[model samples]
Target: MMSISPHQVISAFDEVPTVGHCLVACITITSVLYGLYQWLLPNPVPGIAFNLEATKSLFGDAPGMIKEVSVTGEFRVWCAKQVKKMDSPICQVFIRPFSKPWILLADFRESKDVLMRRKEFDKSSFLSDGMECMGSFHGIYPTGDKFKWNRQLIQDLMTTSFLNNHVGPAVYSKGLDVMKLFEMKMNLAKGRPFSVKKDFEYASLDVMIEFAFGKNWVHTATGPQVELLSKLGASEVKFDALDQPVSFPIAPIMDFLESVYEAPEIVEKTINAIMPKLQTWWWSKQSWYKKIFDEKERIMKEQVAIAVNNYRSGHVKTGIEHMLMREGARAEKEGREPDFGSEVFRDEMFGDIVGGHHTTSGAMMWLAKYLTDWPQIQSKLRLVLYETLSTAKEENRLFTFEEIRRAKLPYLDAVIEEMLRINAVTVTREALCDTTILGCPIKKGTQIFFVSNGPGFLSPSIPTDDSKRSETSRAAKLNDKWDETHDLTLFDPERWLVRKNNGEGLLEDDVDFDGAAGPQLAFGLGPRACWGRRLAHMETKTLIAMLVWNFRLLETPPALSSHAGFEGIARVPQQCYLRLSKI
Candidate 1:
């Protein structure tokens, strides 16, 4: 409006170009930032950076067999003579090619910190993936609000009360079933070279399936269900090795093979076809046939249906049933939709069976091998078990939880602990968040791993430096060599047992056998700790007690060489040929 000079007009035109250039620059910066974000935040993969190479280097390379490597930087320790050479409780190692870094923590104190802080860390994606892979039948994978809801339901079910009331009986009955299988095998073998491992696997599978699904899948005679169960078990064992890190695109291929060989497209197609029928049977409001059909549903509808039926019938007699009923009721009360139907429930039940059964069996195998190799310790265990069972009806009779508790077998406990420490059955966990561990800054999405095969023997008898009379005496007496591999070879149960100077009696000092304050890292630490620890402990203890109580285990003539075998996802004990005989 005001009279503009020629300079003012030119200035206005110049401002227009300036504004356009500023906008272009802003757009360019934003584009670059977006690209950078994409590069930094890649999609999650199960066991993404697990250090397979390190595991091979440490455990001796079993090419094609070892799948995933733990991200724990433990290779140095593995090669070293001791378990605590690293300054921190956990040590970090970065692998090449993928830049996969792992934290290897064997220090008990640091492990405790990680184990106790559940909210800060969670079960790694690797664990979740395995669970999901097994839980697919029930849609347990693809965790959502529903999966959360279902997990809540399951938590209630796995409580001690439920375990005592229902699951205990089922487990006991299943134990009997397993015993029968062992007996049958014993009879058939008649001192022949029979594979007890294979027999134990089948028996455990049968027991778990029966308990979860309310039906038996294993048979002396082969059929579809039997064949499928066998295939699934074998496949699970194979997948355990492959559950490691590598550049190879093997997951899809493994999945495809597992699908084709084990359960197959036909199995899924059959399941899909039967799903509608199963739903009809499950949802029928007015049918008395619900009970009859529910029992039958174990085969068709899977374990969830069996559990639901048990719940509806007011039979909270098993762990699975208890979990299902509690979950269902809680969901109703909270006005949340039920996440687990019959199919999902079945998947979870089967998951427990598959996940738990072999581990216990494997422990038993090791117990047999160790006890056989160390007869003196076996005698000690037998004496303790016999004395504990003195008031019981018979030696071979199924032992109760109380009896197991009272036995207080230190050597037996130590042997089991040693096996768990030396021969790990599970893989290391992945870190979920950017967290500082033992004063080291761990970025978010780091894969944390651990190994049990170390030379550190967690013993209560070992004298602490503080307890010695003089600093020199402490240093001389408590030599660093005690922490070395040679000392670890002294896997004597008495190392856990405190003794008097007289060597004639036991010390009155309380033994913290659980390693609550000691250097042990078997079950892992933090919020994502093993959910089934109690069950696992009980199973291991029971199997050990039973085997040691009756049978005398002998190490094979050649000392039965055992290696940790890999089948992609699982790290398991390689087949050990052992010698066994009736006590």
Candidate 2:
């Protein structure tokens, strides 16, 4: 070969890689590849349809959902739209990075079966974790001994005896207060629409507070506002606009009401967050959060003390007193001291106040919006109410709680059911073990969100492979199909009425209300379904009856009547404006 100089040999050796350099280079390449495989890539459960592009990205479905929420301010609608987008009754959505994908199930039959009969599913950690900040014990607990015990504690609150005898009058009286406030506003508006959202919230808070605390609990939000408004004449009360909806000043909310109102907002934020526990911790450290937490604690303690004293004096009438009595009975039976101040007791009381007020308020707000939109339905409903409660109408007085409850007015039922169907509530369930949903294998620990606004409830259902469905779901007798003759998406009350032919060989107007006439999960289903179902129905019906019976909900401008919703603990309407004419 040729003569090689020492300098050339040294230069060649210097260019060669050393062991230390090779080790560092190998580690850097391994880390990048590992990150792409583990963190950046979207690994989905097999056999479940998912967005192809979503699977290619590191953020997967989260970026799309976040963008949708940011633009529309509706997370609930975005959730339901994913099922339609996938064109599958059951689909996978990878939202949380590096975590298991969420299963979005749209089939009502499978959903019902899973909620009602399937033992493999239970309350997911997704729900419990979001609510854990409230307390250790409540209805959000997974199906277990703890959940059962919690249910037993508050089971009596929903009893027919307690609801009719105790809660009915309180809710009715509150409803009257709301009507009174609206009547005053109607006079001031002189045909202009006024925002009734705060009125609804205040009234609901009043009812729920009395229910949880007691009739003796005198801290009333609406009561004070109503009193304050009464002092001011029609001229004194100012309006921002004559043609559009007027915004009126509301009374300062009590610490208790403020705390309850704020708790759900925090819960919503934590649930939607990527890191819920960390988010909750951060929230817990905030001054506002601490104030609300402490305020709630102070109010609960004060109310419980009052309730205990009342119970001793044989004045037990509210939900908390009933709970204390239950604990006492349990303590007597078990021969141990009743833990009246237990976390379970406090949390359950607070939970009821939080959930009860929000759910009822949302439904009522929506009912007002619907009434304004469908004047024919509203007039028909009003006529039905007038005829059904002729005795009260003739007397020029509102119907009694018992009278409304005892009435067999099918149209009223149809209206409420339709409202509920169109505003279907979402329920989330977790696969307790490895299971198959609609024939697709769902891994254990998967969170399956049951949304009612999609598929069978509000839109045409996605094509499902019936052969793949579980045996129970396929054979479910309670799987009732919707009548697609009418647009399933429209807000039509007649869809819930069962019209039969008379002996004259003609269709009769005497239709009976059939709640099972279609697919809906408004209050959920199964044993774990909303225990507050009866309470919610009664409150909504009574309030709707009272409002329709007392005033006609005149239509407002399109801007004032927008059906856009803000998804919180419930999907409440953004606008609940009403132009009222006293009957």
Cα deviation of 47, candidate 2, in Å: 1.3
Best by lDDT: 2
Tens digit of lDDT per residue, candidate 2, span 1-583? Answer: 8999999999999979999889999999999898867666788788888988888887889999999988777776887888888888888988888878999888888898999999999887787778767885566787788878887778789999989988889899999999999998888788899899988888888888878876667878888888877887777766666666766777787887899888888887787788888888988899999999898888888888888888778887899999888888888999998888776777888988888888789899999889889998888888888888889989988899999988888888888888888876678888888988887888899998898898887887776778987888778786344676568878888887777644311112577777888887888888777778788888889998999998988879888888888776677888889999988
- Candidate achieving the largest TM-score: 2
Candidate 1 deviant stretches above 4 angstroms: 1-100, 118-120, 129-132, 135-148, 177-193, 214-300, 336-344, 393-410, 425-433, 455-486, 498-514, 559-571
Name the TM-score of candidate 2: 0.93
State how far residue 375 of model 2 sits from its true place (Å): 0.6
Error at 166, model 2, angstroms: 0.7
Tens digit of lDDT per residue, candidate 1, span 87-182? 233454433213335555443333444556434555554334333334433222323465565566467555677555444555555555545444
Residue 100 error, candidate 1, Å = 4.8
C-alpha lDDT of all candidate models, in order = 0.47, 0.83
